[model samples]
Target: MTVTAEREPAQVATLDPAAIAREASPEALSGTSRTPALLIEHLSKRFVVGRKRKPVTAVHHVSIRIERGEIYGILGANGSGKSTLIRLVSTLLTLDEGRVAVFGHDIEREEMRVKRLINRVSVDAAFFKKLSPWENLVYAARLYGLEAGPAQREAVRILSRLGIKESRMSRPVEQMSRGMQQKVAIARALLTSPALLLLDEPTTGLDPRSKLDVQTFIEELRADHDATIVLTTHDLDEAERLCDRIALLNDGRVVAEGTAAELKTQVVRDHGGAATLENVFMTYTGRSLDEDVEEESDDAE
Candidate 1:
């Protein structure tokens, strides 16, 4: 399990669900009065490694903003700083420099308020092995200060929509497949109706069918709940299918940012006709997005 510092300065309590929904009203969302759901400025993170001590810059002066109700995708290879960025925004890691804000509240100054506005679901979602999915989600709900009755109902509803069977809700999470556990983690995050949802490789390690299920669930969440999402993934096809806009991150920096079609158009213009997203990624990052690390390892041996 990942661990970080436990204490931070307190801020105002989280806004009520009713208040958040009211702010997300169609009129509010359509008007200029709407505040951005997330704003990140000049973010950077570094890690120290080795006995001789070397500094590794995981993220370097990266900045982006996600509007309310938008699904923004970050596309990158392993160790390219996507997860590090998410952790910084979620306040799981203190920033080495720069700033992040959620719903106009500064993450550093208003940590609790920022925490309330967002929830993160990474590939390796932590859960109690002995607890059932329903029980785990209920526990999460309690932590978020939700009442038992409404929390239980919402958990069931979200999980069911994610293709989890009602019959399996009582089984221990350890017995469930990885995909199912992922769905449960997502459901737990949605139970609090967060304004900003950070999903770090949410579909990683899932079979095709399960990936589709999770993708569909994500679309529905944005449509029905007006949630803003920031997702990081190495799956270019999934990014093309699900993202409203994508940022291509390579070596801790954003090399390109545009809609999928826009990116493809740029590639075609630069590299002659018949250029695809794959070609675009190759041209910009000098690496194929489909090249698996395991395949490289096998070849090396």
Candidate 2:
């Protein structure tokens, strides 16, 4: 794989405000890419944890083609390479083999251009803990070349839509609950109007109601904006509800790929089981959906 970026990962990592600030452009914000939203071919990424230990193959040779405006989900157990795949596409991790393209622009050949077209939200988002939600979002908007006055107004609209009160906008993010902070992260990613949004375990820690709020907003974004979302989550119901198609990953490789209903029908026909995503997971991965969720850690997911 070619080195597509000259900068360090921190500059273009998830929620990369500094990188967005440096590379923002009017065309980037226009969201007018005519090609498929995302294309990946034989992608692979491995991590060298120690000299004595062999490399960990985090993402195997995975290939996927996502059409414009589709909501795609990468569903897997913990450490199943869900987040690793998202990181690879978001330009946070380098590829060991294969290629990724966003809107016909090759990620390696046109790194900066790709950066402008995409933004990422991870399970644990970072922020200026001391800064208010409005402050943090406006700062991100400025990085994306959006005008501050309009940016602030848009931020309010977004947070309010997410069920955050206007009164909470001025308080330090450190004071907010985990679910509220996650909502703020979603708002920040949307502030730039990214054409391709990468969400890694977006609802991992939220309560049921908060999860519902985020899921509803996600559906609305796909319906109302020029947004193609790639979501990585283990929530079976969430994937069945939000994703247009789902890919189940196991041990860093795709075990099954199809719409939720398709997968369920497949399992029932081939494996003799209930027609549900939960059954689909069990059929393919040889384990229950909730098995060992806490034992194996997903690296920096």
Candidate 3:
């Protein structure tokens, strides 16, 4: 199980469901006099690694802001701090440096409130081998303080919408495909109607059809549920297809960021490479991990 830190810093907000729903109001998604759904400023995290026990920087001073109803993608190779960054936002890891705010509430100060407003779906969907999809989701919903009857009905609705047959939801989750299991995981996370959904490699390790199904569901969630998503992915095409904007991370820092077209144009015009996400990834991350950070010039078109 993914463990999140559980300590209050005093003066935390209420965990009331209505108060959390106000955070996801239509005006909030419209961005009219509203703060970002997620805001990170100079965020950093380090881990003590190696026999020498020296601290290795897992995430440097990375910063990002995501508006409500936007699918913001974080792209990086393995160990580039993509998952580390997600953990920091989801409260799995405490920040060694910097600040993170969800819907204008400080993560460290208002952790319970933040937890109520967001839910995470990791790449691997964990489930009891003997439990069916409906049973698993109902159990998870009970943990989130939902009545089992309502949660189970909603689970069937969501699973059906995600292309899982209602009949199959009765079968053991262990008997399902990885993609099917992922769909169930997503359904479980949506039980509380999280305003900010943190998707940590949600489509990883799925077969092509399952990958497409999950991708379509992700798109539908943004359109139908008004959920602000922070998605981390290794698939370039998936990012381009599903993300409104993307940040390319390298060596624990954002090396470049922009819309897919903007990034492609930037690489082609500036670096004279083929206009592809592959080129953009290579141009920004191919350098030494210890290289100086790439600076962004605000005047650029």
The C-alpha TM-scores of every prediction are 0.87, 0.86, 0.85
- Candidate 2 error regions (>4 Å): 1-34, 296-301
lDDT of 2 by residue, 8-30 (tens): 11111222335433444433333
lDDT of 1 by residue, 78-155 (tens): 777889999999899999989887777789988987777788899886899899988888898899888888998888
* Global Cα RMSD, each model: 7.4, 7.6, 9.4
Runs of candidate 3 with Cα error greater than 4 angstroms are 1-19, 22-31, 287-301
Candidate 2 C-alpha error for residue 225, in Å: 1.9
Query: Largest lDDT belongs to which candidate?
Result: 2
> Any residue pairs clashing in model 3, and if so which?
none
| Pairs that collide, model 1 | none
Question: Residue-wise lDDT of candidate 3 within 178-201, one digit each (tens)?
Answer: 889999999988876777788998
Worst 10 residues of 1 by lDDT: 1-10
Among residues 3 or more apart in sequence or in different chains, the pairs in candidate 2 whose N, CA or C atoms overlap within 3 Å are: none
lDDT of 3 at 185: 94
